[model samples]
Target: MAPKDPLLGTLKVCVLNLQSDGEMVTDTNPHLASCCELLELVLRKGLQQPVISLVHRDYWQCFEQLTHQDPCGRLSALSLAVEQTRVCRKLLSAQGRGRYLLRLALSRKALPQFITHLLHTPRVLEWYSPTTSILRNEEFVEPFMSLLLVLSHMEFKLNMENCSFLDESWLLPVCETYEVVPCREVGMALRYLSGRVFVLNLKPGSQAYVDKFICPW
Candidate 1:
């Protein structure tokens, strides 16, 4: 069920649903192949959404299996997937989902190349327009930010893990500077903006807190 506009977010949700349900989407028929590619891109975008908690679980598992089957090729594909995830997270958080999708479709793998190619793509700059109302609500903000942090840590060029280290006794000042603005932004919505932060423990209490804070829908 495509929306009236059938923008990228809608397409991504559909594709994720299909993947989660184990639908046989592949690159066999030309049109279907294109659809698979589109779905892949959408999944990349969905990685940035706030609603899907296990963003990389299934995809990464499938990718791991693919790599085990063909280590050489699948590794490259994995790298590309991670890069796309980073790009998608950056675009979605800074911009909006529709705009990010349009740019993603145009710029596909614009990371290792020239940023000029990315800038030249349509809808890339459209996100900054004051008139560009968010197609999706801002509830996606937390997930978007959390994914941005994670993806920023795990991208192709930056193969680092996330380490939460709060610059002791400075969170309030930092939040005071960045969190207060004209609009109710994500920075304001995040509850820990005023606290000493550390890598959220995923075992128990901290894990539950992280799940509440960063869990994708």
Candidate 2:
């Protein structure tokens, strides 16, 4: 048979290193190592090829399995990986495939649980800031922010009761910031979320005016 591809081999090693318990091997570089392998796979085989597609699918499957086994640990691993600019830029800039993969990984059935976890977990939401100054300085907040964006695009209904963590007082300020400067993906996400908030008639207290402020166009 043909000699094994180094990048593929590396990817296999990384996947195997992810223990069934939802933790990754501390010694392994999940982001750099996985990103390098992904980049190589995309460059050499292209995303449509059977081999590359299988690898991509398998990588996500591993994450999903781990997530099901241990939500907190899986989110921790994902947060760590996405904090790397190289990994974030690659995943966020790949013709939107990164976003697609993320959406797929957090299927509708799992989204409510994930969002609930995000809100309840202090460490996970620590980076979420209502202040523009704080948000601007925070570099590791993208993964958390990206999840909200993906959730905005989901088709299924969200349980309003589970959304108690979404304090309107704080969310309003964050939404206002997005409206003024428009942070691309974030702006879109805010817009979508705002629309949903209005449609759902979720009480936003003083932030109810957000419905009028948001441009429907």
Top-lDDT structure, candidate number: 2
lDDT of 1 by residue, 21-123 (tens): 3433222212322333443343343332224564523222222233244334524534454455444432323223222222232234332222222223333
The Cα local distance difference test for each model comes to: 0.31, 0.34
Clashing pairs in 1: 50-143, 50-216, 50-217, 51-216, 51-217, 52-216, 52-217
lDDT of model 1, residue 204: 37
Candidate 2 — worst ten consecutive residues by lDDT sum? Answer: 164-173
Model 2 residue 120 lDDT score = 50
Off by over 4 Å in 2: 20-44, 47-94, 106-217
Predicted candidate 2 versus true structure: per-residue lDDT over 1-217, tens digit per residue:
6333454455444433432325322213243224323433422231122334434332232223333444446465444332331233323233333333333323333433444444454443333333321122233233334433433343332222222222221011122322433322222223245324433232343243343454423
All-Cα superposition RMSD per candidate:
20.4, 19.9
**Which residue runs of candidate 1 sit more than 4 Å off their true CA positions?**
1-41, 44-57, 71-217
Cα TM-score of candidate 2: 0.22
TM-score for each predicted model, relative to the true structure = 0.20, 0.22
* Stretch of 10 with least lDDT, candidate 1: 163-172
